[model samples]
Target: MPGWDDNSLGYHSDNGKFFCHLNMTGIAFESNNLIKKGAALYPCVGFSMLQKSGIGGSAEINFGHRMLKYESITNFDI
Candidate 1:
């Protein structure tokens, strides 16, 4: 298993129209599936962010039990 930590920052519009969230993940160690013992490992970091806005009518819509609609969804990774 790999140990990890996350730091997050977020903001939302006062009018409930727009929102964004950012996260930074830090890995404590390296892991490999094929090599179990005496394997080389290194620590690393990652980042992600999401931004969404209301369009047409609202940011989201729901129908019955399973249907859903998102105005916009954007994701980033590094």
Candidate 2:
């Protein structure tokens, strides 16, 4: 749980919810979640697997050097 600890925040991709420290029941913010001023944030990714037979998952990372399929957000101020 990314936002279970202090100074941590996370956005749940499946349910479109946003979580902030100790907030287990996150709020619905979707893609418009904003960061507080002066908050130092970093980019990260995580994955998990369920305890079940024949369950599997994979992740692919792109560092922006290749052509993206969709238009990227370009209005970020910082």
Candidate 3:
């Protein structure tokens, strides 16, 4: 994970009805998976886009947060 202690820059664009949220997440944590951590901010109107690029696969993701996670599998028998 990298560091976010430095000055960060971000933006969110809108074309009348839709929006795209941009973020530069340089904050690093003491964990192997950086995606598992972040600072949640205010919720706004319309659609949004948040991108995070680093050393990790992108398929492991959830569409939205929830109170309880419904997993198809947790452990393998073999």
Candidate 4:
């Protein structure tokens, strides 16, 4: 699944016990507008992340048979 996130220069300040992400947060799809292209519809979830420093941050991801393709495809996370 393709993912996206905003900057993190000061996104985290240890300000609160927990942090909330912005709305319009992110989106994911099993298949695009590729029906005509023979793309099969599968389930998938996008991932989210926030880093305050290099290798420092929190990550949110989506997974499961109900959400992602169970077979016929290999998953790659970045």
**Candidate topping TM-score:** 2
Error of 2 at 18 (Å): 7.4
lDDT of 4 at 22: 28
Question: lDDT by residue for model 4 over 1-78, one digit each (tens)?
Answer: 222334211222335654333223243223223323232335334434446544433445555535653443324531
Model 1 TM-score, 2 decimals:
0.20
lDDT of 3 by residue, 1-78 (tens): 112224332332333453233343533232123343445443323322355543333333444675436643424632
Worst 10 residues of 2 by lDDT: 23-32
Error of 4 at 41 (Å): 0.5
lDDT per residue, candidate 2, 24-43, as tens digits?
Answer: 34322322245434434456
Give one digit per residue, the lDDT tens place, for model 1 in 1-78. Answer: 122333322233336775322223422222234233332334333333334643222333333386445443445632
Against the true structure, candidate 4 reaches a TM-score of 0.22
Candidate scoring better on lDDT of 1 and 3: 3
Q: Rate the local accuracy (lDDT) of all candidates.
A: 0.34, 0.52, 0.36, 0.36
Clashing pairs in 2: none
In candidate 3, what residue range of length 10 has the lowest lDDT sum?
1-10
Clashes of 4: 3
Model 1, which residues run further than 4 Å from truth? 1-38, 53-78
